[model samples]
Structure formats: structure tokens, C-alpha cells
Target chain A: MSLINSTATEALDLLAKGQITSVALTSAYLQRIADTDDQIGAFLRVDADAALARAAQIDQRRQAKQPLGKLAGLPVAVKDVLCDSQTQTTCGSQMLASYRPPYDATVVARLKSADAVLLGRTNMDEFAMGGSTENSAFQLTRNPWDLNRTPGGSSGGAAACVAAGMTPLSIGSDTGGSIRQPAGLCGVVGLKPTYGRVSRYGLVAFASSLDQVGPLAANTTDAALLLEAIAGHDTQDATSLDAPVPRFSAEIDRPLTGLRIGVVREHFTTGLDGEIEHAVRRALDVYQSQGATIKEISLPHSKYAVATYYVIAPSEASSNLARYDGVHYGHRTDRAELLDELATEQKELESAGDREALKNIDNGLVRMYRRSRAEGFGPEVKRRIMLGAYALSAGYYDAYYLKGLKVRRLIRQDFDAAFQQVDLIAGPVTAQAAFKLGEMAGDPLAMYLVDLYTVSANLAGLPGISLPCGFTQSGLPIGLQLQAPPLAEDTLLRGARMYEQATEWHKKKVPI
Target chain B: MAITRADVEKVALLARLQLTDGELKMMTTDLSQIVTYVDLLAEVDTEGVEPMAHAVEVSNVFAEDEVRPSLPREQALANAPGRNERGYLVPPVLGG
Candidate 1:
């Protein structure tokens, strides 16, 4: 009977029937966010006035008998990586602290078109780097389920907001389990659509090849609803898939009677915490009870997914983030006098940087390129960038980048071969439940291992969804991931919906 | 277990980032720990096991050699910390 905790579908039904106004609904969510956000750190920015204004428009249209989109004023939080025209979209970095984009990301534009109220941007690991939100330069978004524990990141804030009931859904970008891992730890549902399934045109890049935008919501249906609204061809993104967006929600009731679920052998390794494994097993029972067949399959190459992901992700990130030098965008120090005087500028920039990078920057007339790059990027971001530059660096491209490419092909082949024999792949979303905050900070590799179970999907270009299947005795939620072949998002959703309906894990709310 | 001061400087230069001696000393330890942890990869025999690059097999991505609209010069230039009349501004490097 609670209005705030109701699913998006239920909320939409109420709005369509005039049982509630978008203004009222948005206000209610805002009130909840205001009460809980200080404790949860879910939002990096909240524009109460903007949210209400948008909601008022939706209410007005509905009263006038005009058409309404499916969401129709639902409030959804967006990750900081996505652009928000009215808010400064700093991706947890001091460099972009004061910058605001003039245009909304494609997903944001779609949400606006659907009449969804934009709640505000949420916190994330700086440039979506760390597994725990601890890497955020601004704030650490505490896990809603257990504040003492981490909200698995870099979509940490978005996931925490939904789990804390700040919003029914939120948009998050996943490069490597950024959406799903947090969704699992926070006890929410997160969907990582196939790469290119959702447009990445406006997403601030972390790793170009691996980066993707997806939705994190309270339940499978809500997640599906958001996906339906965001998925489609985006002319602005060259690599975006041109396929028609599927009716994700419509498949909620799709029969799973003949589902052939593949239990990935590698997911059951000894490194997995016992209770998490149990939860996955329990969730698997849902399919078995529904007359679906379960088969154990080997993705032997999967053992190396994390290793492959780190190298490739950082390498790509190194390249993609190369644009954020102190010169062109986001963060600069004053002392720059040469920009006005051509001769002075030429003298300064020419000697300032590497010849190759200098070509990209204008220093007086001579132009300096790499020097600005030298100043803008952070150490963690820079380390990866350098690795990428070196990978794509002369003389090493074939040995490093090309070798990585070959391995990527092999990884995809493993998934391709596995998908042919199974309707879907099932496993824990992470190696174990969320670890203590700062536990992995000193060991970046340990943090990356948190993504071992989830990164394979990114490496293979497949759709994966993570839902709270069970909980550890310590009370941490465990995610059961369901992955399907490329463009098989519906299968993953359908499988997840079935499991969700069969369990009460989704109903367990965080006492925010 | 320890990254030398020289190691930190080398990495900093490679990354095109600056670090003070004090920061360098701290990073030497921190970076060394991280490097050691990631060295777990060394345990696995990846011989002939090609390194995976992506989850999907997408190759030769192409764009029509066509010009399209881009963000305005003003918006693109909005985030820069240093800029002057013509373009972005930077610290002096002529001494180099």
C-alpha cells in the first residue's frame, strides 16, 4: 500500500488512472531522498525544483487528456558519468568539479521524452575506476543494505538509492560490473545490456570498448521498463547497434518451461563464499521447479577473464580519457599567458611536450599537445592511460594491443560456443559478497577480482542481469547472474523475472 | 614489497603526471602493493591462451567519412581550467 516503494509499473498504472499525480509522486520521492540521502550518499546532486517542475508538466498533460509515456514522471537517479544539462555532472573528480554539459546524454533525453522526472546525478568511483565507491574523490556511497559494508561500485550510488527507496530506478553505466555488482550488493536488480544495446554517446568514458549504459532498479519489471525506454540505435555513437529495441517488460510472463540454463563451472570455484554459492543454488531451483533444465557447462577460458579485462579496460580507458587535459576541458591552472601572444605560446608549447601529443594542442602557433595531457589526468587514470598509450604505442601495438585483441576473440568464442548449447548462463554476480570498504584499496587486483564473475559478459559482448538470489549469514546479499547471447536481453530478463517471482529477496528493503 | 623512488618517478613520467617526493614515496609503496597483487596473473600459464580483449567479436568498426554536428566550441571548452583569447592556456615549458 506504500506509494513510495511501489514498482514503476504500479506507479505508472496509478498515474494513468489519476489515482496519483506525477507532482505528488515526484515530491514523495524527493522527500524520501532528502531524509535518507545524507546517510546513504546516493546522490551527488539533487535539484528539487527541477524535479517538481518536470512532474508538474506530466500531471498537466495527463489532465488535459494528452498522451503520456510509460514512465510519465517517475523519478530516476542517474550516475555522474551521464550528462545532465541542468546539473554539474562531475564524475567524482576534482578536474570536472564545476563543469556542466549543455546537452543531456541520449538516455537522459529519452527519459525526458518519456516524461520521467530527473532526480539528479549520483556518486560513483572516480571515473568509474574502483569496485567500491571508496575510490570516489568526493563521497563514499554506503551500501544501503549494510552501511558498514560497501555498495559495490562504480554504480554504487545509483544502486544504493534504489535499495534505500530514494527512487524506483536509476540509470548506471557498466564498464565492468559497475551496474550489476552494485545491484547485487545493494539487493536490487541491475541489467547490463549487450555492448551497444544502449547508446553510450553521452556517457563519460571509462573504457570505450567495455563501457555501456544500463538500468538499476528495485525489481526485474522496473529494470525492464527502464531498458525499454533507453535501448535503441543512436546515430551519434558509431558502434551503437542498429537493432530494434525489444519489449523487455512484455517478456515478464514469457514461459521458462523449456529454459536450458547453463551453470558456469568456473563460477562455483572454492574462492566463492559458501552462503553466496548456496543462494545461487537456491535461485537455480526456481527454474528447476518451473520445468526448466539445468546443465553444467565449462567456459575454461573464463578463468582468465579478470586478467584480460584489467589490461584491456585500462588500456582503452587510457586512450579514451586522453582528452581531459588541463588545456581542453575540465580543470586548469592560471599562469597561462601564451594563449594570447602567438610568439610566446609557440615558444612555450613547442618545448613543453612530446612531439606526437604536442600535435594535438595549439601553443601559440607552434602548438603543444601532450603537456596539457600531462597536467590534467590523475595518477590512477594516468597510469592506465600510459599503459594504453604504450599498448597502442609504437613497436608494442602488435605484442600488446593486438595480442589482447586475439585473446578477446578467444574469449568471445568461448561464450559463443557455450551459448549454442544453453538458453542462458547462470552464476554468482561476484566472486563473493561485497567486501568491507577499503579492504581492497591497497590491493587493486583484489578489487578487480570482485568483478571476476561479471566481466566475462563484457569481454564477450553478451547481456547479463544480476538479482539478489540469496543472502549470506552475515546478512550481505548475493547476486545470481544470468547471461545470454548478444541481443538476448529478453532471455536474461525472463530468467530473472522468474527467479524474482519465486523469491522474496527483492522485497527485503533497507531500513533507510 | 617496495617500489623505489625512481620507480615512482618513472611511472609518473610515463603517465604524464606530476608527483612530489613525498607523494612519490607514498605511491612507491601503494603502487608496489597493487603491482604485487595483480602479479597473480603470473601464476597462470597463459601460453597459447590468447589474451581476451573484449566480450564480443567486433572488428573493423567503421564510420562513414562524413562530418556530423558536434558540441559547440564553447561547451567543449567549458571544462578547461586554463584558457585565453584563442584556446586553452598552460604552464610555462619553454625552459625545457
Candidate 2:
């Protein structure tokens, strides 16, 4: 097999045996990226020289028989949402187009500590605001399976890079299925660990409460490996769980006898495409025949997950995004231009003898802020900020934002009650397989509704995984979603691994 | 409730964003459709339910209140679109 087709685990085994050097592996990926990135658009930036240097250092350590980190020499791509000291962390937005953070996010730090080569930064939706990477301010990343279709997003580039073999492993932040949605579309394994399971210290905030950093990889085992390397407590993030990190890969091969798999009845309702439902049901059969108990379950309040998430996420976003004015950092307008405009306004007011209007003109700072934000954000971002501002406005607070919060509680309650009956919940990751580009364009609501099956896990702070289940007649991959109770990713991984072994879906290569 | 052009204008002002007349019209329609869809939450009976802010049950996570090394001034200000000796430069808040 070609070097690019090897999974991270397989490559690591070769490196340990001295059969392959880190420099060779990293160079192969860099060369492939140069050759194919224009067609895939998976990468926003690739620092080839830095990557090779890091890989050579790892090789030197190995050749000298010195102690090495767990992921020594592995190349890993990171979503643009995370802060990296070596690259501009744009969060895939024009607002921070030239912005580079001085400090790396905790996850990036951990990747370096593990001796992994920093592959490069990948593209994403502007601030993770949309499901499709089409919301990216840079280039749109196409699904590796079909260039005419989208790689589901805001972590679209993260998943596409893995699917396209540009990188063996990539880390992405999932705020309402950004990681898993794109992973599913691109036919790879994506895991969204329980909220607080992974530190959110360096992640660009979208919906603070729902965001989590997790892994996207070629298979379940590699996904678990990447997750273990990054998951842990950090003092920098207050929400970071203080619990000891579990050896996630240690449990992947364990047999899951008598595991209770709850099939969410609500997930199979109207609008779920027939092929996806069929594939998910077939996956349930694989579990049932393997000594697992399949029970029908219902999360009644999940009907409101999309509605609740929309209101709550945007309300938080409006507040979180307020830091970007033409002041401390990010894009700013020229002061001279603002001053000239201010002079014109003041002269006009003086000629009209309207002294009161001059007081507002004195606040040219506000004018600069307004112009900078208006020019900086894209249409989707501005829409969310407006929605958030309206929802949090004094009179509407109780009706929209507050009510959304209360509904969120009910959604959590629904999950808590269901977990008591089953160990894991199984369902379709998305309503359908990857759709053609521009299929849902012009209607943001249509795009928002596609998140219905995946958002509940995020709303309730549960860990969920999306793995390839089967393919459509047109060769599009379908995903089966398995969600576990809080911090039960080990259980989720074991179940997904069993399905992966019994089926050939994950073995099929992306046509790219 | 249906959002109007006036509501979009008000929200835009509150968000400190200066939307053009064309954008304002488009946003008025878009927000109206989105708000109407999200209005489905009103159908749920959440009476007396406590509002959930964070998904996990976490309280004030405090660290020792001690001074720590911070980012150097240059690195912190590296990404500023406009900066100067004092700090980030901005338009005058006071009339000359």
C-alpha cells in the first residue's frame, strides 16, 4: 500500500519498527498536499519547512534511542478554530484574516508535547457558525467522495483533509456537530467528547457552553488515539473536567456483550432519507446479533433541540463576539478616514445650528466600531449577531433567550431519563448523506434543520461519534451515530469498533 | 413575531454593526423566517424549569489568585490591525 493510505496507527507501528522515518511520512503528506490541495481545498495553510524540521527532530530522537512521546513523529492537522502560535488563527473569518495568536491553545500545546508534527491549519466556517464549510470566508472544501457536493462543516476542512489523505489525523471543535457532521459527510470517524471532557481553552468561542475539541481520523482506533492525546484537565479552562483521562484506545477492542443500545425513535421520523435510515437499521441488527440488546427509545423534547440551540447559541455568540471592535485586536478602520468623516458631519451640524447632534459626533469611537464590525463580518455572522441581540433585548429576553434556556433544561432531562434505561443511544448522524453544493443555498433555515439529529447531544453535553455505516447507490457514504452518557466515549468507541469490523463500509476509499 | 426592517435596524445598532440599506432589507426577511421557526420553542411547556446555561453541572471554578507570567506586550499586540506605542490606536472619542 502507498504511504499516504496508511492510517495513523499503522504508520506509527511502522515508525516504531524503524521501517519508516517521521521525515518520510511528513514529507509524503506535504508533497501530497501540494499536489492535491487545490482540488480538495482542505488546507488553508501548510508550513512544509516547519513540519519537516519537526519530523526530523522526532527521527533524531528515535535514532538515538532516546525517550519519545506517545505520538512522536505523527503528523496532525488542526482546525483553524484553535489558536496556533505558528500560524494565523483566523477562525475562518475575515475579521481575523491577518490575526495570529501569540499563545497556542491547550490542545495545540498537548499535540506538541506528544511530539506530533504540526501538519498545518485547516479551513472552517466563520467562527463555526454554520454546518457547511460554505460559510468559510476562504475557499469552500469539497467532499472527497464527490467534488460536486459539500463536506459537511464548520470543521469541513478538518474532515476533508483526513478523507483526502492530506493528514492522517485532524483535530476539530464541535459546536453543534461541526466535527461529526463533516466527518460523516466525508466518510471518516469523528468523535465529539462530552462537554468539559476536552479543554476549550484555545478554541475560538462560538457557543461557549456547547463547544468541544475532538478528533477526526480514518478509523475508530485512530480517533481514540488522537482523543486520548488531547483529553485532560487544564487550569486555563474552568469548564475542564478534573477527572483522570481514561485510556480510550485500551477499551476499543473489548467485546461489548449485552450492551444496551437505545435506538432513538425520534431520529427515524419524517425527513430522514430512506438510504440513511436503512443503513442505520442494519447497523442496529449487527449489534443485536452480537448479544447487544436493542430497545426503542424516545427523547420527546429533542423535537425542540434545533429551536433551543438556535436561540441559546446565537445569544451567547452575540455576547462572545462583542470583543471584536476596531480596538484591542483584529481588523480596524483607519483613524484618519473616520476623522475626516467626523469633520464633515460636525461642519454640517454647525451650519445647521444643531448643537445636540454634535454630541453624537463626538463619539467617533462608536462610529469606528460600527464600521469595522459591519465590514468585517459575513452575512451569516451578522444575521446571528442580530438574532442574538434581539433575543437578549430587554423585553424579548423572557420570551426568546430565557425560554430557550428553559427548554434546554428539559432536553437535558430527556437524556438523563433515557440513559437510565440504556448504556448508549444509536441513531442517524444526519437526515441524509452529503448533498450537492448549493442545494440548500439561500435558505439558512433549511441548513439549520439538517442539524436536528446531531444537536441534541451537544445541547445535553453528551459524547457522540459518527462512523461510516454504508453507502448510497450513488456511492455517497452514510453515517451511523452512537451517543453515550456523559464521559462514556469508551463505550461509544467499543460499539463503533464492533460495527467497523463486521462491515466493509469503512474500508472503502474516497474516490478522490 | 415577524421581524420588520425597523427591528433589524434597531438590533443592528445594538450590535454595533452598520448594515447597509440593502443588507437591512435582506436581514429583515431572514430574521423573520428564523425567528418564526425558532418560535417553536414557545410550544414546549417549560413552566417552573430552571434555565440551563452550561450543559454540565459546574460552579465557579477558581484558581489561586496569584500573579502569573503573561504574554509579552509585543506578541499580545501582534495581531492588532491598528496599534501604537501607548496601546491599540482608535478613532477619537472626544471632539478636537
Give the clashing pairs for model 2: none
Candidate 1 per-residue C-alpha lDDT over B1-96 given as tens digits, one digit per residue, 9 for 90 to 100: 345677566545555555556656666665566445444445444467665554444567677888888977777667666666557665655532
In candidate 2, stretches whose alpha carbon ends up further than 4 angstroms from where it belongs are A343-362
CAPRI-style class, candidate 1: acceptable
Model 1 chain A worst lDDT run, 10 consecutive residues: A362-371
| Whole-model Cα lDDT of every candidate shown, in order | 0.79, 0.90
Best by TM-score: 2
lDDT of 2 by residue, B1-96 (tens): 798898887888899998889999999999999999999988899888999999998998899999998888887777777778657776667754
Off by over 4 Å in 1: A334-379, A386-399, B1-8, B22-70, B84-86, B91-96
For each candidate, report its DockQ versus the true two-chain complex. Answer: 0.30, 0.80
Interface RMSD in angstroms for candidate 1: 5.5
